[model samples]
Target chain A: MRIVVLTGGIGGARFLRGVRAYAAADGAAVTAVVNVGDDAIMHGLRICPDLDSVLYTLGGGADPERGWGRAGESWTVADELAAYGAEPQWFSLGDRDLATHLVRTTMLNAGYPLSAVAAALSRRWKPGVDLLPATDQRLETHVVVEDGDGQRAIHFQEWWVRHRAQLAARRFVFVGADQAEPAPGVCEALAAADVVLIAPSNPVVSIAPVLAVPGLREAVVAGPAPVVGVSPIIDGTPVRGMADKCLAAVGAQCSAAGVGALYGARSAGGLLDAWLVDEVDADAAVPGVAVHPVPLWMTDDDATEAMVRAALRAAQSR
Target chain B: MRIVVLTGGIGGARFLRGVRAYAAADGAAVTAVVNVGDDAIMHGLRICPDLDSVLYTLGGGADPERGWGRAGESWTVADELAAYGAEPQWFSLGDRDLATHLVRTTMLNAGYPLSAVAAALSRRWKPGVDLLPATDQRLETHVVVEDGDGQRAIHFQEWWVRHRAQLAARRFVFVGADQAEPAPGVCEALAAADVVLIAPSNPVVSIAPVLAVPGLREAVVAGPAPVVGVSPIIDGTPVRGMADKCLAAVGAQCSAAGVGALYGARSAGGLLDAWLVDEVDADAAVPGVAVHPVPLWMTDDDATEAMVRAALRAAQSR
Candidate 1:
């Protein structure tokens, strides 16, 4: 089966490890349509957080301690940048991490599309899955804030890193998204997919941006493949990241029921043909969508593979 | 006196070390308008070679062994970039060196002009000389090449680093130079100078690009201050760098006299009112430009200060 998965970062990358295992055993092809909303230019190099997480995890270089960044990483470059008084000092650039950024940024400047660049970068990792950027154009995710002064738009990183997403967000704006065309092969992959799985990623920041690009969501909905979404929220909270803060911006509750309702059924114009929530939320109701309850924690390759198998069955039914 | 010096890289930076010493002792306000033509976006970082040289040399952090890059540099980043199969691999970005590039490239992307970024960077170095990029615009130096593949333009790094300047050049194009205006305050420094000394830098690549910028050379030639150029050539060859190859591109010889004649005098529409050559080449003459002979080698601070004194005397005569 041609499996197409939409993913965010760390959690998504780890889940990909499970998917890769399954695909390797079955000779299946997996194409991951990664979110570029978290993509940023830090220290002069373009960093696609989700893409890197997935790459590093599958490539066996991910740090077990931090759960992100390259394993056995050194901080010589970060210390130097700090010594020079570079601000937003929280995010770190490992010596090995910089190599990936340098290559990505260089190729981006050389006019290669981000999708092509991701493919080129993947050659070294050989992650057993095709990685595709949602769009090649600049589609920055911005948070609209109502400060004491007034309303203004803050770049995603400013909200995430600088403020740690503390401010009450009024709305989220996917800047340049209106004009952004889907990356080459993204629409085709979605249209041709036998199964479409949305991994438990940030609904507002990750999956939303992937869906925001012009033709991507429509393609998934129109395809013969059934679209399935795994809930990022277990009972009523995210496993990682500031997804609750972003969900609150759109006036949505943090519960699995709330997210499932937000993405009802394809016939109802919401995202889900099937919604997979945690077993804890077995009693949850998502109108017009096929709702199933499963153990959602992806603690190991076995747990993740179980989740993947459940998602595959959900898609196969429709 | 507010002294202004025009400089290139390595040699220019070493000369600035002596100038800074003289300026500190005499309490002179020194401003260096450095050439940015050697600047390139390497591996996605904005690399100002001349500015870096000045910063490292005056900050006392320059590698004594390589005479460029930082002291106690590590190549972890370069090794990783190589592992990823990065191109144009001759120039290595050491871990320490990568920090400077990261900071500069990040700031540039944040919309700070190169001149302002240089000012911000120099705060850490406190290089004593006010280092200003010659132009805010990207005026990359490109050599026009004629080969079996026909005529093509390659980046200066490709020609210099990758090819090692082995290819014969028909002409050197300062791409975007005609559209580039000098960075603010460059003309003001030129006009306000008591004396302007052109450091013993590569005449074609460094000095020529500064002159190539619209109105900068004209402003220098017409300013009240008498401008003097110190020949980079000694004993019919460049003291360092591939100045001979670049000089030949502009149809000039490698001898002190050949380069001296190339700059002629202000009245004849070139760079100098006076030309400084080695004491051995004192007889090498140009018609209108005053010629002075001095020990041009900056083997130490004392030698550099002596060269500065000689330049002042020559300016005083004119």
Candidate 2:
């Protein structure tokens, strides 16, 4: 099976790890389309948070403590940047992590697109799964907020990192989305895949931006592949991240049912043939959607792989 | 007296350590105009070799063993970059050193000139000396080599770091020098100084590029201050670096008097009221140039301060 998986940050990367193990057992090839909405320029490096998280997590080199950056990372660069009055102290750039930025930045300046850059980067780690950004062009997520006079647009990082996603977001704008082209192989991979899985990541901030890129949503819908999404929300709470806070920005409920409705059926153009929610919310229904009940907590790779297998079965039934 | 010194990498930064001590004793303000010829875009970060050398050396954070980068530096980034199939590995980029590039590249991308970026970087270390680049504009030094087809231009770093400066050079070219404007405050500091000291740096590659920029050489020659140059070549050898090789590229001999004649008196339009040579080369003479014999080895602060005082006396005599 040729499987295409769309992922976000830590939760998404972790879920993909399980998927990788399960897919290898079943003799399947995997291509990961990563979200770059969380990409920010930190300490002068172009940091693609979600992509790096997925890369590091799968490469057996991610810091288990931070669940980001590289294992056995040092902080000399971070300390120096901090001493230099660098802003945005929240996101730390470790010594090992800097190597990624340096190479990526160099390649980018040398005229390689993000997809090609990711391909080059993946060659070193051999993360076992092919990785691709949602789009080659920049698709920065920006949040509109109410200032003293009126609404002002803030870069997603400023809203997410500096403010801790605390303010009421008037709108989420994916800057450059209008002009961004889906990365090479994305459409072909979607068309040829046996299944498409959206990892349990924040729908509003993470998955939304991936789908927001032009032609990507249509490709997933038009494909014969069984498209399924794992719910980030369990009962009325997110499994990880500030998804609840983000959903509030769109005036949506934090419930699993609400998120399922938000990402409705293929008939409704909302990107799901199946939606997997926690056992507690098994009764939740969406029109033209196959719902499944599972433990839904990725306590270990085995548990997460079980969830992946269950989602695959649900896709087969649909 | 307020002193303005011209410097290049390693040797220059090391010499400044002594000058700093001497200036502190006299409570004098010192400004250092650093050579940007060695600066290059490696892995996309603008690496200013000389500026960082000076910054780290004065900030008490420089790596003593390697004599560049920061103390307690990590090489994870370099290892990763290498794994990604990066080249020019001879020049290592440490994690802590990357912070400086991050700040520099960021500021440059944001439309700030390099001189302004240097100021911003200096603010972090407060290295006491008013450090500045020779020119804000790109004035890259290129080596013209006899390639398989014909002569082609290669960047100085590639020639120096990659080839180890072993290739026979047809000529040396300072690209963009004709168009480059001397950085703000460069001429002003030179014009008002009591004494101007040329550090024992690569005469052709380092000092030449600084002089190549328009109006700078003229400013030095016309300044009320007397300009004194220290020979990078002692006897027939370079104290550090491959200066003898670089001297050959410019058709100059690797001797104190040979370099002094190359930077001849005002009648010849080169900036040299006095030329300081090591005690071993004291007998060598250049027509119409005052000569000072001193222990030019900057083993520590006391030795460098004595050299600085000798240059002052030479300038005062002129």
Cα error of candidate 1 at position A102, Å: 4.5
A82-179: candidate 1 lDDT, tens digit per residue: 89978658777899988999999889889999999999989999888999989999888999998898999988888987889998899999998999
Residue B66 of model 1 has an lDDT of 91
The TM-score obtained by chain A of candidate 2 when compared with the true chain A: 0.97
- Residue B82 C-alpha lDDT in model 2: 78
Residue A190 shift from truth in candidate 1, angstroms: 3.5
lDDT of 2 at B32: 91
Docking class of 2: medium
Model 1 lDDT per residue over B1-318, tens place: 988899887988888888888888888889898999888877878888889999998998899779889999888889889988997588788899889988888788889999988999899999999998889999989999878888888877788878888888778999999899989999999889988989998888888888889988888888888898888999897888898998888899898989988877787877788889998888889778899999998889999988888888899999
Q: What is the TM-score of chain B alone in each candidate?
A: 0.97, 0.96
Compute each candidate's TM-score over C-alphas: 0.84, 0.93
Give the number of the best model, judged by TM-score: 2
lDDT of 2 by residue, B1-318 (tens): 878888888888888887788888899888898888888888778899888999889888888878878888877778877777787676778877888888888889899999999899888777889998999998888999876788888999989888888877877899898899889999989888888889988888888888888998888888888889888888889988898888787788889998998889865776788999999998979888888988888777788889888888888988
Interface RMSD, Å, model 2: 1.5
DockQ of each: 0.64, 0.71
The digit string of per-residue lDDT tens for model 2 on A1-318 reads 888999888889999988988888998899999998888877667789888888888888898877767888888778878888777777778887878887887778778899998888887777889899999899999999986778999899889878878877888999999998789999989999999999999898899899999999899999999998998888888898789888988888898888888888987777899999999998888788898888899988899999999989988989
